[model samples]
Target: MLEPQPTRSEAAARPELTREMLEMVFDHVENGIYLVDGQGVTLAVNRTYEEMSGFTNVQLVGRRLDEMVGPDNLFSGSASLLVLQRKGPVTATYSTSTGRKLLVKGRPIFGDWGEIRYVINTIWDLTVVQYSQKIDADTARSQMLSEEDIITCSEKMMSVVDLALRVAQTDSTLLLSGESGVGKSLLAKLVHRSSERRAKPLMQINCGAIPESLIESELFGYEPGAFTGADRRGKPGLFEMAQGGTVFLDEISELPLHLQSKLLGVIQDRSFMKIGGREPMTVDVRIIAATNRELMDLVRQGRFREDLFYRLNVVPIKLPPLRERRDDIPLLVRYFADKFNRRHRCYKQLSDELVQRLQSLPWQGNIRELENLVERLIVTTAEEIITPADAQLEPQEPELDPDATLGEMMARQERTIILSAWKKHRTTRRIAAALGISQASAARKLKRALESDIGAENQS
Candidate 1:
């Protein structure tokens, strides 16, 4: 099916015309095109690129890409410059003077002598495609993280887990804020386990558990003869020791103000000096800090540094308390019971009625308290089928709020109904339809319910 070739005279006459036609086609192509020589000098660019970048071919053609990167430069940086530096293909995000976000892929072509001849940069508007792709990817990743023994059925908690997994994909500092036993430590481990640095050590230190005097020496290693009773060989700090992994600083709110300042510097610079060492030691470590107390409150009270709090709060992940995620209670109970049963080599089961009762009771201490209660029951009860009375522990009765009026109680009940429906359906329209109310009313009630819960927690 080969086509007839053009005569030599015909081809010769149209060579220049064909080249011009091809160039015209390139200018009209949808994807942005940028071509640069080996020395990073822009050689040719299509109209699509000129339009996308707001940089005309006349201004770009003769200039070096590196010259266009700086405080007063047209570009933040050039992908072609990266291609030149790496001597290979590279992918980057670039921003133009017009504030358009470009996702660029730069490929370098080498000459026969192994020297780069030219670089071709292909670009597209990132907001047009990548933004939606990122959301889809994040949703898929969140589902995977949820499947990893997290044992949560609540959409709210699933969202939290998804966020944690997304942050885990980066080396950015993470701050986990929640009440005690809300599984901050567990989430911290999950982040570490799911991170690029998972192969390395996941060093954990309890800021609250460590003594103040020794904490500095322990965190920032001390040199020999720097302090009395020091070992002859200096010890590396936790940051230094975890060179390529994560350092989970549990109860970070308990970190002294002075130490918090030092932690901030380490986080910002990726370097820290030992307690007694003269030179600053650089470390390639990720910091994952967890706190049972509210760090913002500590900052407001002057017990924590505001600068340090901001540094650690780059990716703040707030964990929902067990009471808020009551849907997970039954799954957790079954998981713990099975775990204890295997450990003790005993066969036991929880009755449906007892499980329901446990789900209804407020788990004030959260997962840790629930686990302990389960283990205690598993070890003490001899019966194969355990009852609520046989467990020998009563649920902590809620204190009566005598200040509340009957109308207020009714409002609280109504709020609960809306919240439960919203949590299950996750859409205002669906929730409203299920509850036989207008979507706007459902949304307003749901917002108030959430705000009320937060207010109650803050008050507590």
Candidate 2:
């Protein structure tokens, strides 16, 4: 049986709802509510706002937003003022003197003559909800794994994160060296969020992805008519846009030698000349560079500048491959499963046997490959429980016996290497070049590996 719903007339006819009851209902709402007049004069605030901002009713009521917002004032900014200025709804994030970060959305009510009447501001505490937390190794790591999305329980990754967080406070250049899809970009973001410049923009550019002809202008701004079809009135580059924040240079090793020299100059002097501009522009930004290749090797090959390598290597942090940190695979699998379930609005679970099987494989593509596999399983699995057969993983090599002799282990490893290189390069000569060995030795070893495989198949 359904309950009868009250009509608008019936609800208005109820005189039992008094002003005191209305105030109670206002205070009981989960989100903080703030009200102000058309002129930005504070009218009233609920109790939730008081607790969230550390401001009392007496302090806020009858005051102007301009009076409460300043360096030494109660709040750093007011969304109500922005609503008044724009005569529309405004959503913004600001800090309070009490060390709380808040996200507020202010909507304006209109008068009979189309004038602004009241501004209703709803607030949510961002500090407690999103970013701010105590920095203990165990607790913080767990919280970050769930909320911050860093997801790691391995000691090696934990130590890497700790070092990155510690150096994030300073302006030292960071060199994040790791394999592709190992979360170098995510770590860079974590560093930025934990730094003093969190409020500023984090500008990122991939050196390899951008074209050689436009890479220079993309790093340093160009004047109007500097090049064909350039933006009129000039434009700001990544360095200019990332002022007072951080610039993440992804695939820094792919940066051309000439541009590398300019980048080194920027790190050395904090300034660069714009395209077709006579004056050099000064910038204040922290640089966090990432590379999948060895910069030192590029330097030796004269493809990357040695000076730039040294400048960006002030705080070098190497992230281990996924195969090395197998402990995090299960956690990552569960996280991705839940994420895709919510996204696709479906209920799915991976079988325990499937998880164990996944953990055994070499994740050559790292966390990214695992995440993609989990999403695919969640979306494509016909049943609630996804089994190993649903994964359709490629056939893997047999695991070596634990009691095998050192010589046997070496021979097996050599065979595996030769076989893997043969699959990719196909020819012994190409395999030798890829593996940095002679062509004759590659052919001999490849033949030996095939013979061993045939003998093992016969025995089986």
Relative to the true structure, candidate 1 reaches a TM of 0.55
For residues 1-460, what per-residue lDDT tens digits would candidate 2 score against the true structure?
9889899999888789789999899998978999999999999999999998888999999999888765566875677876776576655556677776665667889999989999999876644323342323311211222213455656688678779878988999999998878989888877776677876666777887878777787778788888788877676777887778788899998788889989999999999999989999999999999998878978897888888889999999999999898876766776678668867989899998899899899886798899989999999999999988888764666677889987898888899899998886788966887688999999999999989989999999
* TM agreement with the true structure for every prediction: 0.55, 0.59
Summarize candidate 1's per-residue lDDT along 213-244 as a digit string, tens digits: 87787677778778778777666667766668
Give the true-structure RMSD of model 1. 21.8
Specify the highest-TM-score model's number: 2
Worst 10 residues of 1 by lDDT: 138-147
Please name the candidate that would achieve the greatest lDDT relative to the true structure.
Answer: 2
- Report the Cα RMSD per candidate: 21.8, 18.9
Worst 10 residues of 2 by lDDT: 138-147
Q: What are the lDDT scores of the predictions, listed in order? A: 0.76, 0.80
